[model samples]
Target: MKDAWIPYATRAVPRYTSYPTAADFTPETGVAAAMAWSAATRADEAISAYLHIPFCDKLCWYCGCATSVPNGYRRVAEYVGLLLKEVSLRGRAMGPHGGIGHLHFGGGSPNILNPNDFLELMDALQRHFGLRTGAEIAVELDPRTMKPGQVPTFARAGVNRVSLGVQTLAEDVQHAINRIQPRDMVVALIEDLRGAGIDAVNMDLMYGLPYQTTQHVVEAARFAAEMGAARVSVFGYAHVPWFAKHQRAIDENALAGLHERFTQARVAAMTLEGAGYVAIGLDHYARADDTLAIAAREGRLHRNFQGYTDDPCETLIGMGATAISQFREGFSQNLKDRKAWGEAVTAGHLPAERGIALTPDDRLRARALETLMCRLEVDAAEICAEMDVPDDRLDGALDAARELERVGLCHVSGTVVTVPEEARIMLRTVAQCFDARSPAAAPQRHAKAV
Candidate 1:
């Protein structure tokens, strides 16, 4: 990595999974806004739903997800009941949408739910939201903690996609991260999921972890390819112990330095590409025949809270503690505290704790940012025209891009801004130029751009 790029790589920027990112959410625009937005959905449009399961059998030290070890099943069962009630409440609040076109189960670990409870939750989702025919049901799994019958149960429940948390294959790296699943364990689980007819497996790999090397990253990526993973996401470990408490367990001194982290990311990319996977976006690689790759090729790809997706629904309803929902009006998040979330649902209220209402400017900037992040380039004039805003409305952002251009981070050709292939890893930084809500310098609040 060039020394000139170090400053940009170390800067923090919103991932732009959503414009006016979660940092802009507040209590002033909470449940009432979420309800209004839900009620305003077009009846003819299909919607998507996300159910979060915030419990894990064991907490991994490096994990940043909102999850805890519920030593007993009691808390898990209670949460599931509350989640179902919340789902019903949200269903009644929504406009007469066509149906749920995509249903995603994410978590600390969605597989934490008892097999029967998981089934019941699925039934409730279908009953209340009307799961559209051929809807894709996707779940994120922790292969280390997945219960014996869970894979078969998921298959029986019509789950078409399963994402496994296989962060690394190196035993030492796994030990450093406090997640010690062997490569063979993940391989066996992949086989089990495929044998049960759920073949769309996505693997999550990590680089820049405590004591991780470029070779470790390469080996992990190769393992994903060998396991026939449809998609592989190589994420750089964000050491934010102050934010994610459990992350404090990680020894900061053992972590890869900035340049090492950058190299690891590049090595992972090369390894996945060498294994016949097409790079979809900054961090995701998909098999040449995978839907995600196809989506990217055709410009139908989308970035959401779940990272990258092919789902094109205009509305996304999120349920469970700390889950975030996206609507045309704005974004809403369920209460992060379990008790508060449960109480709200029990009281027949949407659990939205904080959110942001989108302004016309917010929408315009959001589209430009998404275009740049997803496509690695954006025609500023074209985006402004599509949003029905005057081209000059984005003059400030274009000016910001000019600075990046001078640094060789991106190119600004009139109203078009493009990140060169060499600067793809810094794509978030380029996208940040258009983020009006982000402060000029707020590195403490977000992960490094690299």
Candidate 2:
């Protein structure tokens, strides 16, 4: 690790997945605002939708997502009913938008749903949302809990892409994080998924976990390569136990230090790039022929709640408890309380609890941030021209990048700023320069930059 980069690596920053980050959302803008945004969608436009399944059969101690083990399928079934209601409620609320072009099912392990319920949910999404033919439907999976027949059920339900959470193959490391699916378990699942024709498989891997090492990250990357995974997401485990209380279960002493974490991340990138996987901004790697790689090569990669993606829909509808919907006019998130969310949906109202409406300035900063995060470089003047604003609109951001330049995290030349390849792991720290809402969030509100 570069000694000069050490001090900056520990700085807390937003992931720039959405900016103004979810940190800036407020009660002042609630479901009413969400309805206004969704209600204005034009019929000619394509949109995306995300369904959040906030339940897992067993919780992974290192997980920072909003999820809990439901103890039994009864709770999950009830949630699915609520989700189905929400699907129709929000779908009918839209103004004949040109159907869902892309759909994502994220979780606490979307695979935890009973196969029948899963199919039933998909059917509702299709019936209410007019799911565009050939839409890219994706789901996040937890292999350990994946049922015997989910692959076929998912395929028949139009799931073309599936992401498996395969954090690590090291037994001791797995035990440390309290998620232990053996290597062969993942292999068998992959084979089953491919055999069922769901070949657009993505794998999620992580570094900086308890007892994790550089070689452990390499082993996982190599495993993804050997399995012909379409894309691999290598994340540096953000150990924010305060935010993710269950993370407190992780052994702090067993976690990798800043320098070691940096090394592990670098080695993982090296392994993936060497194995013919194209690095997709920040922590993702995609095969040369994968759509994500194609998007990156053509400068079309987009970052969203799911991280780097090729999905380019401007509006994304989010459903279920704690789900967040993104619109050009603003963003809204559903209530985190399942009971409250269900009650609201049952009452025929959008369950959005809080969110932020984007201002003109917010939109500009977000565009600038997305450009830098996706391309690793941004020209302030170029973005201003695209937004039809004065070139100086982002002058303050350029000045901020100059400070980061002094620290070796980024370079600011003229009106353009670029993160050096070696400093890419700290990309969020660089992107934070364009965030006007950073002052609204404390350091503890986000994870470490590295």
Candidate 3:
């Protein structure tokens, strides 16, 4: 499977993080829909939030996030001020619902904010949407920029989990990607975070990077294990220069080919498993005792825009420029332009620019796709029954899977499609079969399956 899969490896597919993915969002559904949906949060539901900090001190060429290098702190301060207003606006729009169960700070680097600024934002979130008792607060950290005092400050604000961006440990690979952080920098930061009561340390590692080899991938995975990382996410670097222009800075010639990338992903998974970590879903590996691993084992695992998660919240308030919000009705995204986002927030309006309202068909297919992506298998018949649709509703997808099975992509036992372990890297390829959004017609919109 490893050597024979190269032809399909480079074929692009949506991450299936969301059904109808972001590519299907349209301007037809804008702020009014956002407002109506936001106000409809279930009274008994415990919601989640994603606060996007679109500022980073430095730009990493390999990064493909909605962020920029703010030359000065002035822009960041202004962004945060508006973000707080947006939070209040969102909270009020979502009147009288259960409190927050999961709060995530993601960005170019969420830790780019000063300690005081971080605290101020936390306070605003608490005031607006109270964090339910033991609610998970997770932050994505940049080890090189993390200050000594920020660790404890994060803990003080109830940040119990952190994910350090440790893409590669090899000096050459680090130089190639332009995200330089010594291994010791990450080690020290982890130790400090642990000392500050932030014990759920998740390390994000990457394969398929420029100048990266299987050895480089293995060393990073091993380092995550040695440093006691509770969760390690091994991501395949997606080089989408057309989408993320900074990627043009990387030397495309130096990037690993599909075969080599497949090898690196395999090696990284093997190394993490060798260290007693359980592979959760496609790329995440967690200690056997970690909540994420336990969730995967107990069938409580879920996938979101943030990848594999234990978060079961139905409503996610996305606050910031280019942030995408999730609700039972559908999805909405804040304005991608900072000036536009700020103006909307300042005018006391929902900042939603574009989105897609979920159709019943979309939701049914979404459940099937997420189930397959999370568990590597899905009984389409069972899903259709659960969604109150006909068992034959997904006959087209089963036929698609049959075509893939001829090429060894999946096994279709009646309506149950199963992706073999060897096909895990191409999980999206199998999952995309259920995507009703015409994924194959928009190949360049997403990354390669590998």
Candidate 4:
């Protein structure tokens, strides 16, 4: 049955993190738009914050992020200083928001920061944004490089959740990806984090890496379960060497075929489910008591640049180099180049380089795409009615959905488009039916639909 999903996996499609996707962002919509959106944020509206730390001790060959390995702690410390300055700049930009309900720290190993730096950064954020009473402070950690005092520092700073990047436990697999961390190291990190009162631990696992196999995938999944991970994200490695030059280090021949990749993913899913985890949207799974699982069950799941999330805030302010922020009106990105970002921030300017504003049509299509991506289905009439879109306006999308129906990717019964459970992995191709801009040209930038 898993092999049956092979043919459809060959099609390239966007992950649908956003309707138009990041490939469509242009320089014309820059810092001005971002500033306007930030200023317009209602005082009573809850906000989500994402802080990027773009430094790592070692560069993973398969990494597809805007990050680099710093030569020493001096560079990382320097970045933190700049980040503090940027936080103050952003705090002034937004001005007295109600409170921050969600704060996420992501990047090239956020755990690499010294304990003092991490706590200072948290204090700066808390002072500026006013952390809500029960806000969730989530940080992505690279367990391999976590310092001794980091966990306690996180707990002291009110960190509630920690996501560890444990891509795989096999020595050969880790070596191939140039991220060598053993299973014991990960277990120790989890234990330490748990001991420090951070009970919610999320582990990331990968299936489609070069030299990865079904056995390796299962092993990683079982290990995550054994370590009592509250949530697990299993992702297929998208080999886009052209986009991520470091990926070229991977041997093309060592990569699995589409069928094998599907099998590997299924094996991991089965292993996790057997260990009592409920599958969340797409590639995430959570324990029954986890907030993510509750979100999935209640149909309150959301798709963000970071993938599946339980955060319900309409606005997300992303700070630091290469961070992307989402506002009620649009999406904007900071400069990807570190030097340019630092220079712009130093000059008392937002470091935005590109962005896209949402038109009425864009917002409507975005709602529909997000619904499909989160729920694996969308009622075209229902959503259009809510958005007050005319029936004739969505004719092109209806036609596209009908065409997809013929391909067995979706079933359009009246106006409700549903992707069967078996075809859930290819749901992005189904949701792409609603995209109006360059749908034909989408393939050039998309990862695989499956």
Candidate 5:
């Protein structure tokens, strides 16, 4: 019904979930910076935590997450052991923080670990940082690999939310992506999680996969609402075979074109918003009463490694291989190699391998990008005035906005830039206007924005 609005929203750009996106992270900045930032968390300040479980039971062709298929439980178990050790190591480095207000488990599939291992992991985390009284503990699950008793493991670990990766319910599409699961199976898993007291369920849906169409995307959106998903994230499939090797398995010829991808995303937005879900950012939607909805309505929504979130804690301590931690001053990322990470932790050193220290310019651009991403508008003059930045310093970004405005994607007043409501899908392109990285450096670096 809203087909006329599709053509204007498909431009590709960085999600701006972070300024100087992950593509900008390099080896020049290392563990020392991360440790210092972690140690800097005031004893009375609560922090957010993220743990990466990079092992998956099966590899989906469309997945771009940092994960690999472990041949057996031994590899995963080994990773878990190292994760726990890093947990303790980072805990020591953090000294005494107030407590963790938000704890998130993400990856290839967090549910792949055995129930007991999962519980012990949570216990180890609590012992280290100490969890806040009403903190939010969230995990991303692969319903296809979920075990019978794992739901209880999540509930017992005090997980208040579970995000199930149900990319699509169409059998053929699932088969094409190598992540098949019947619709009934997903519904059952939702019911099971709810019965186990994990009432907050977020379902991940996608379009532009091999053989996907706007019709399929709409169908999936309606089904998600029918299943009572509190939140649904509709992501346009980003095809980057050279980067994500498994993606090569996806037939490029069958993948939807950029315009079609745009329609699919728009269809999802229209369907979910029609179903009473509030669109929170470029890709996430939540029910009216959801915390994300509250965050958006109150202008408290935040963008993070996990995309749109409600967590306001400034320090984000990341654990496990290749995990990235954020602090007020900078970011630190753990080594991607399991053996190397474990060895570093065993040696009583943080396993961080690379990072970036945020410069004042980086911070300013970051705030500007976040404002545009979350609120769809930015008062450049006002923000610069508040930050004591010279107005002329943003001339380059203004020039970029002029180019976008010529195309009718955004409007620029004397000191403000506002992305039109219908052009929100192109918000990333607008956000990229402030990126300080060279074009050659970032173009080859990230997935297409569509």
Candidate 6:
């Protein structure tokens, strides 16, 4: 890594997964906004739904997800009931849509539910939302907590894709993060899922762990390839103890330094690319034939709260606590507190507690940011024209990009701004230039750009 880039890489920046970001959400735009947005969905357009299961058997120290350990099944069962009711309410609020084209189950771990309970939830989703024929159902799983018969049950329920949380293979690093699934365990789970006919496997690998080395990161990427993972996401472990209390259990001193973290990221990227996985966006790698790779190749890729996806649904309805829903109007989040979320749903209301209404400018900037983040380049003039706004509306952003250009972070040619291949890792910094709502100075509020 160049010393000149260190200052840029170390600075905090929005991931730009969503323009205006979650930082802009507030109580002023709550349930009413969410209700209106859902009600306003065009009947002819297919939509996406996200179900968040915020319960896990074990809390990994390095996890930043909104999940907790349920000492007993009663809590999970109770939560599932509320989740189903919430689904019904949201479905009714949405009125009639083309049907659900994409369904996603995420969490602390969706596998935490009992197999029967999991199937019931899936049934409820289909019953209420009218799951479109041949729609994609994707779920995130923790191999450590995967019970017997779960794989078969998931296949029976029509789950087509499974993302496994296989953050690291090193025993020392796993122990440090309080997640100790062996490499063999993960490999066996993958084989079992494939045997049951759910072959679209996505493995998640991490780089900046408490005791992770560049070799550890590289070996993990290699293992994912060897397992025939359809996609692999290499993420830098964010150490935000204040945001995720469980992360405080990790020793900060044991984490890799900035340069080491940068090297580990590069090594993992090289390993995945060398293994024939096409790099998709910032941190995702996919086999050349995978849908995500195809999306990137054809420019159909999209970024959402769930990271990169090929789902083209315009409306993403998020169910359960802390899940964020994206609509044409803006973004809405269910209450983060489980009790509050349950109460709202029990009262026959949407659980949305805070959100932001997207202004025309917000939409325009979002399009430009999404374009740059997904394609590594954006034609500002084209975006403005597409948004039916004058090209001068983006002059401020283009000027900002010009400043970054002088630093070798990006190139500004006419109304087009492109992040160079070498500066791809700093993509967020370049995208941040177009964010009108970003705070001037609050490094602690976001993860470093790298």
Greater-lDDT candidate between 2 and 4: 2
Candidate 6 lDDT, 1-450, residue by residue in tens:
778788888888888888789988999999999999999988899999999999999999988888999979999999999999999999899956998999999998999899999998888888888888999999999999999889999999999999999999999999999999999999899989999999999999999999999999988999999998999998999888888888989999999998899899899889999999988778899999999999999999999988998988779999999999999889998999999999999999999999999999999999999999999999999999999999899999999998888889999999999988778788888998889998343778898877
Residue 324 error, candidate 1, Å: 0.9
Per-residue lDDT for 327 in model 6? Answer: 94
Q: Compared with the true structure, what per-residue lDDT tens digits does model 3 show for residues 21-118?
A: 98889999999999999989877889999999988888999998988998799989999899989989998999578899999999989999989989
The lDDT for every candidate, in the order shown, is: 0.90, 0.90, 0.91, 0.86, 0.85, 0.91
1-450: candidate 1 lDDT, tens digit per residue: 778898888888777788899988899989889889999988789999999999999888989888999969999999999998998999999988999999999988999999999999899888888888999999999988888799889999999999999998889988988899987888888889889999999999999889888888888888888888999998888888889998988999999998898899998888889989998767899999999999999999999999888898879999999999999889999899899899999999999999998999999998988888888999999998999888899999999999988889999999999998778889998898998899464867788887
lDDT of 6 at 183: 92
Query: TM-scores, in order shown?
Result: 0.98, 0.98, 0.98, 0.97, 0.96, 0.98
Model 3 scores worst on lDDT over the 10 consecutive residues at 1-10
Tell me the tens digit of each residue's lDDT in model 5 across 163-184.
9898888879989999889998
For model 2, give the 10-residue run with minimal summed lDDT.
434-443
* 1 against 2, candidate with superior lDDT: 2
- Tell how far residue 232 is off in model 2, in angstroms: 0.6
Q: Give the TM-score of candidate 2.
A: 0.98
> Candidates ranked by lDDT, best first?
6, 3, 2, 1, 4, 5
Count clashing residue pairs per candidate. Answer: 0, 0, 0, 0, 2, 0
Candidate 2 lDDT over residue span 1-450, tens digit each: 678777677778888899888888999999789989989998889899999999998889989998999978999999999899999999888977889899999988899999999999888988898888889999999999988778899988989999999999999999998999999999999989999989999999999999998889989989999999999998889998878999999989998899899999999899989999998888899999999999999989999988998888889999999899999888899999889999999999999999998898998998899999999999999999999899999999998899989978898899999999998898988888898879324779888888
Off by over 4 Å in 5: 1-12, 438-441
- In model 1, the runs with Cα more than 4 Å from the true position are 439-441
